[model samples]
Target: MVAKQYVPATGDIVWLTFSLQAGRKQAGRRPAIVLSPQSYNEKTGLALFCPITSKVKGYPFKVILPPSSRVTGAILSDHVRNLDWRVRRARFEMKAPRQSVAEVRAKIAVLLGSGMSSG
Candidate 1:
C-alpha cells in the first residue's frame, strides 16, 4: 500500500514542524493556518501557511481565531510561510471559519501593500 500524500486546503488549520532555529522565527511543532488553495497544493506539493502562536500580543497584523475554530491562537499574517508538506509533517487539524481566514488574508494583503476588498 502506498502512503497517502497530504494536501491541505485553504482555511484549514494544521499542525506542522517548523524546526531549525532562526532569530525571532516561530519554531517547533505547532498549529498553523493553511493559506493556499487545494488546487495549488496538489500541483506544487507546497502549502502556504500563516503560523499561529498561542501567545496573543495584540498586534494589528495578527488575527485571533475563536475557540470555535478549535484553536485559540493568533494568526500571524506577517509570518506567512510556504513549506513542502513531505518534509514538514503537516497534519490537518480542522478547517477554520471562513471569516477568520478572510481576516488573515486581508491583513496579509495590507502587509504586502495590496488591497483586498471585503466583498
Candidate 2:
C-alpha cells in the first residue's frame, strides 16, 4: 500500500532534505514552512519554502515562528528556495498562523532587497 502524497500549502510546516551550502550540498531533514501557493505545488510538485532553525543568526530576513505542538524556530527567509517533492520527507500537521505567515512573506520581500511595491 502506497502512502498518499500530500501537497503542502503556504502555511504548512514540513520536513525535507534541503539543499544547503549554495545548493552544492544536501543536508539532513529539517522543518520548513511552505511559502508558495498550493496551486503551484499541485501543478509542479515543487514549492518555495523557508527553513526553520533553532539558533537565531540575527539575519534581517529571519522571522520567528510561534510554538506549535512540537517546535519553535525562526524562518530563514534568506534560504528560501523552490524544492521538488522528492526532497520532502514528512509533513507536519502543524500549520503556521496567518499572522506569522504574513510576517514571513514580508521578510521574504525584504530579503529580495528590491523594495517590492505593495501595489
Candidate 3:
C-alpha cells in the first residue's frame, strides 16, 4: 500500500509557520499555487513566506521546503514573488481612515511582533 500526500490546491491561502532551530517562532501566510499535476518536470510545493512589504523587514525567517522540493530555477525567485505579494498586501491594508503614522507603526508592530523594526 502507498501513502497519499496532501497537496494544497490553487488559490488556497496557506500559512507557513517557522521557528528557529534554536527555538524562536516566526509565522506568515500567503496564497499558493499547486504545480504538481500540471507539468511533468515541475515539482510539487506550495508558495511560502511571500513578503508583504516593499522593503525587506530584516527579520530572520526560513522557508521549510520539503525534502522532495524541486524547482527549475533559483529558490530566490520564489522568495521574490512572496516578498512582492506581502508588500502589496501590506500597502493596501495600511490605508485606514484617519490613522496617524504612529498608529500605523503600532499596528504593524502588533502584527509583526515587538522585535520587528518599524522603519
- For model 2, which pairs clash? none
Backbone clashes, each candidate: 0, 0, 8
Model 1 residue-pair collision total:
0
lDDT of 3 by residue, 1-119 (tens): 99754333322223333222345222343222221231221242322223222223334331223333221111111332322222323211111122222333344346567777667
Best by lDDT: 1
TM-scores of the models, in the order given: 0.87, 0.79, 0.22
Stretches off by above 4 angstroms in model 2 are: 1-4, 20-26, 113-119
By summed lDDT, the worst window of 10 consecutive residues in model 2 runs over 19-28
Better of 1 and 2 by lDDT: 1
Which should have the higher TM-score, number 1 or number 2? 1
User: Which digits, one per residue and each the tens of the lDDT, describe model 1 over residues 14-98?
Assistant: 9999976668668999999999899998898899998999898858898988866677889998888889876898898998988
What overall lDDT, based on C-alpha atoms, would model 2 receive against the true structure? 0.78
Top-scoring candidate (TM-score): 1
- The local distance difference test score of each candidate is 0.87, 0.78, 0.28
Give candidate 1 regions above 4 Å deviation: 1-4, 115-119
Model 2 agreement with the true structure over 1-119: per-residue lDDT tens digits? 99877888889988887655655433668888898888999899899888788887667777887655465878887777788855565576578878878988887666676866788
lDDT ranking from best to worst? 1, 2, 3
Number of clashes found in candidate 3: 8
Order of candidates by TM-score, top first? 1, 2, 3
